[model samples]
Target: MRKTFTRTILSISFLALMLTASNGYAQQNNTNDEGAQHLVKWNVAALLLKNYSFQYEQAIGRKTSLALGLRFMPKSSMPFSSVLKNAIDDDQTWNSIKDFKTGNFSITPEFRYYFGESVFQGFYVAPFLRYARYNADLPFHYEYQQNATTTVKDKMDFNGGVDTFTGGVMIGAQWSLGKSISLDLWIAGPNYGFASGNISGKKTLNSMEQDELRKALDEDFKDLPLVKTKYTVDGNGAKIDFDGPWAGLRSGLSIGYRF
Candidate 1:
């Protein structure tokens, strides 16, 4: 999987560079340019989703530029609580997520080519590479058989994180907003890649309890689209390991200062 991901990234990056090199015809249409050589931008729309992001872009030539962006999300309650609860519709799943907390960090680098002969002007296509990490904590719930006829329900606290890398393209438009300011509208950008992660907890359990907990985990997440899952249960504790496809989107309004 690692090799595959690396290859995908190299392919996308090479394609972007090739396009930039082959765009010699655009050099003759440079009169449409009306922007500065450097820009600093903030995607304020991300504030609504609790994700703060910023970007710095530099014009490299008559119609191409390079940009890098960083995003950080402080630990907070998981967004869309009601929507997720209603979607799952399971008491056990609900119990685990009622107090769920999460945070994230990511970095993205992109190559942009403007259709109107300048950076941060008119329409543009951007091919980007993103690496993201997601941190989460929740209580895993399960049932344990105590004696001949007694059953106890309990929960184990689990915390862990996942990492992902993906490459994709975006199309957007930017317009100069006064002498030094610019407005960028990310029309739409969708990305796809692979992800793997582990979330585990410590709880001494007998063989019956371990089996029951394994079954509980399966029953809880069976509906999701995970490609594969591996559970480890031993004397001290248990762990849940899984890997699958990861997909994401990029679309927001940004305010920028050009100089």
Candidate 2:
């Protein structure tokens, strides 16, 4: 709920900037621009990864623009299966992670400064803030004592999501195709941020089962970067808590239309 409220406020703030830029202020600079002061672009690079993303840019100054972008991917099979197996040294761990299904949604608001003769054409630098959320599901395995002389090995279904906020800078170049056509290349972007999440399974468990499940999590998720894995267990269910620093990179090839 807090995440939703934060995003809502950002959306409204962006809309206010849009209104101001598109009104008298935009016309005041129309003669100086003599070119398109607005552009909408589709990120083709993201499509290659089965993600859909789009951006809207509005010129707010002679050499500056403000843009808002959104990226989305529906929950499905994890990507790059081969890379996953090769990257992790543990075959058992790889086997377990191989079945994870994931998806994400993100929003980025950018402020750009163009160093070219025109606003939408030439090299530019942009500082941006991004808010992203990711959802995932995995089958977690464990062993528990079911009877005096018997041991049960089983897997429980786990599902949950995370929310993160980050800030970054990107450098890129844009070319005007003709009257209203454009091409934008996002060369490099790196961001750092904090993250928190809860992943859990909904099922009744005995004390012994819960204890064993907690031990399994400690072993399986120990490698998660920059964070300590936390486990919560009860008769109601089991949960994994995540809180840590996150780093990310962004790059894209986009096609745009100016108006």
Candidate 3:
């Protein structure tokens, strides 16, 4: 009787081990069939602004994911015309605005919450952070006494840029075209940040010339509501330091492929 009981117990143990192994194998196979869960996207609106932007997204859970983007604006694509047009007033000084140039690069990281059933599709809310570095030549005007009686006026080139850090919340929608393609649209969003840089003129100025330039800037930019200005006199020339609140609008459209 004892020998018969031992044989039955061994058979049951062997059957249970086989069933567990089969279930584990089936789970592994299912995951392999699902494939990679990531997408790569290009921003079309960025190209229109003469910038190249690329984004990558990966799924972390059923309703949450993370996205990272990189944007580049080469020196050749300097002088973003649209931005300059909006920032500058078309007054007498408008004609003085020349030699406008900018070189910038930025990185953005966003955390998203999807409302729809899929990870990268449907309406979503994302809070994003961006860091950027830039170099630019802004426009300025100055005047000096040509002689004992006559005064002459000319434009001065302000050469410098800023490093900026900002964060904001974005709400947008995305749709899938087929199994492999998707479109992303940014509706509207607000961003706020700070910038710090030096603005130095192309040529060195004497004490009298620096005073004249300061007076000119005060009058010309008094009505402009964007930046708070400070001036520092250096050995080469006077440097205008800008430290203030920055705000702007954000929107874009992108197409992506899933892999």
- Residue 70's lDDT within candidate 2 is 96
lDDT of 3: 0.73
Model 2 scores worst on lDDT over the 10 consecutive residues at: 23-32
lDDT of 1 by residue, 118-218 (tens): 56666799999999998888788777667889988977777888888888999987766456777777878898888888888888977877777778877
| Better candidate by lDDT, 1 or 2 | 2
Considering every candidate listed, which one attains the maximal lDDT? 2
Cα RMSDs, all models: 9.6, 11.4, 19.1
lDDT of 3 by residue, 23-89 (tens): 3454445422235478899989888777898999998988788999899898643445557667878
- True lDDT of residue 94, candidate 1: 82
Off by over 4 Å in 3: 1-36, 76-92, 144-149, 222-226
Candidate 2 per-residue lDDT, tens place, 38-101, comes to: 9999999897777999999999988899999999999887777778788899755665688888
Per-candidate Cα lDDT values, in order, are 0.80, 0.82, 0.73
On TM-score, the candidate that comes out on top is 1
Q: Model 1 compared with the native: what TM-score?
A: 0.79
Would you list the rank order by lDDT, best first? 2, 1, 3
The regions of model 2 sitting more than 4 angstroms off are 1-33, 82-91, 142-152
Per-model TM against the reference: 0.79, 0.78, 0.76
Better of 2 and 3 by lDDT: 2
